[model samples]
Target: MEPEMLQRKIIHVDMDAFYASVEQMDNPLLKGKPIAVGGSEARGVVSAASYEARKFGVRSAMSGYMARKLCPELIFVRPRFDRYKEISNKIRKIFHEYTDLVEPLSLDEAYLDVTENKKGNPSATLIAQEIRKRIFEEVGLTASAGISVNKFVAKIASDYNKPNGQKTVNPDEVEAFMEGLDVKKFYGVGKVTAERMYQLGIFTGADLKSKSIEYLEQHFGNSGRSFYNLSRGISYSKVKPNRTLKSVGAERTFNVNLSSEIFMEERLENIAKELERRLQKSKIAGKTVTLKIKYSDFTLQTRSKTLPYFIADKSLIFEAAKELLYQEKMKESVRLLGISLHNLNTEMKKSVVVQLKFDF
Candidate 1:
């Protein structure tokens, strides 16, 4: 690893069951109970499940019906995205108080580059504990943190002691910590990839490191290189505070499935209009238009068409979407439809390399 990479101090903070915890916090009656945030109807999908509910197999993206079947006593509440965003902003404000190099991955988590911070604090371990402490005291919520030499290790460590806990992987501990790590526990290696790794006798970081980069690239494409570096705790990806917008999209799930092309087109038109509004609001134009379709059985498919010119107008966007819709025959009744614009004009940005150093 490069000397600068080893010097970088990164911390990943993640809220504990953020949405469900917020619901429990606002209403004390829900505390310590098995609760899920999302609709309870048959077609409803679980957005977030409290730890209590997780014991019964309730999880985000699981169908509400299945969640109930797993835990019959589970309680369901509607999602309040506006309220979630409000709290998220408060948390980000706290992060900014420590460092301007805070990169939010979502409403619940973020990566902070604090090698040089506002607090003049050199110990990343102490910084993580203090940040988690402040989040609980000020926001009436708990957060867990992981401190390490780089973003990848920090993110994986954050999950070590979850539900309001913190872990710090000093520079000296990174190698052993990563080698013993289960392949499944490596960040971004989903079930499918893990299964593939297992098939190849790569059950742990050490197993992954045993393979040649050329061999891995042959099996996993570009991701092979990423796997090779992460296993050795050698990621150079910085904490990017101002992440670029790669795509803008809008999707809708209907209460009823539409099988007819005419009905689907009517819904697509409305979705196209919404997409146009979003693009105009962002003051961006793209040359590629993609249409997403979700079937009643919950399968997803996407179709994309790259035009000769950039477009943000509703008519042009709708026309492109319409052509993609008719370009293929429907296989099943459609439950969801979405439109997105990609390859935006505001797509290029220069990356800066900063000196990174880590210490406990």
Candidate 2:
């Protein structure tokens, strides 16, 4: 491979236990506690479990019943998919501040190409560390970052030092680093694939690299080409910029304070209905809801929440929205109300682990 072609630097940033961690950040009481967000009761499932809860082996997608059984002291908070979306948007705004070449994998994970960033900074490692520090200071959140010459190495680097940590892999160290990784940790090898590889005695990169292309293909089929290239730690995929603005919402103001419940209900209903239509036509279903409001005195406040998954139902949208409006206590008689959904990119539903390998 030409050295110039591999000179680009990529960084992967992933928030720590995104949903649960946000809840812990907003409310000090929940800090440092074993917390899970989703269903609180025995029948509920854990959407996101905090680092504390993870110590007990609790994990996202595990049933709530099993989580509590694993750790009796675990605390369950109802999942706020709406709020998580808002925070994700805030972080996205921050990302754009640095570079437009940001590809968000999910609400909490993204690939940032800073090889020729807007800042003109020479060190990708410094950019990653700065990004991590900024997230903590600005958003009251912790993020783990990985820095490498390309996306595959960067993504793996991010996981190496996780939960508010960061790692960087220099160009010369790529071979040594990937050669030492377990086969299971290879980009596309999940539980089933790893078990099959284990049965084949392919425990590490060295073992995977030992097999010939034809032999590996005979065993693993077409994926053998992927295994061959990934064992050498090579990736060529480019960062996809998240530039689409899926939905837009606007609110107006009136000089007189709106004290009539009937008028306010009618007003909220109109805005909510319009927002709902925009989302539907755009094919954007969001778990996050943001309510924009202005006080009688022209002051403003906004509240947002994220849901378990994407939802396009008008009633459900307004229901969560009305709840947020009321929760804000309507301190000043509301002159205007607006609601917007920002988690439009959640539509990228497929597992983003596209092997990150060139099937040579």
For every candidate in turn, the CA RMSD to the true structure comes to: 2.1, 13.5
lDDT of 2 by residue, 1-360 (tens): 675455567889999889989999988999999999977544466889999999999999897778999989999898776789899999888878787778898899999877676787778888888888888899999999998877898899999888889998888788788889999998889999999999989999989888898988898899888898888777777787744565456454444568765577667777778777777776667667888887767587989988888776778877877788677456778767788886765444222322222111
Instruction: Put down candidate 1 lDDT per residue, 1-360, tens digits, no spaces.
Output: 556554688999999999999999999999999999987657788999999999999999998989999999999999998899999999999999989888899999999989888999988888888888888999999999999888989999999899889898888888888999998987679999999999999999999988889988998899999899888888878888888888998888888899998998888889888888889888999999999999988799999999999999989988999999999899999989999999988855554646755456
**lDDT value for candidate 2?**
0.80
- Per-model TM-score on C-alpha atoms: 0.93, 0.69
The Cα error of candidate 2 at residue 207, in Å, is 1.1
- lDDT per model vs. reference: 0.90, 0.80
Please report how far candidate 1 places residue 230 from its true position, in Å.
1.7
Residue pairs in collision within model 1: 7-356, 7-357, 7-358, 8-356, 8-357
Angstrom error of the Cα, residue 231, model 1: value is 1.6
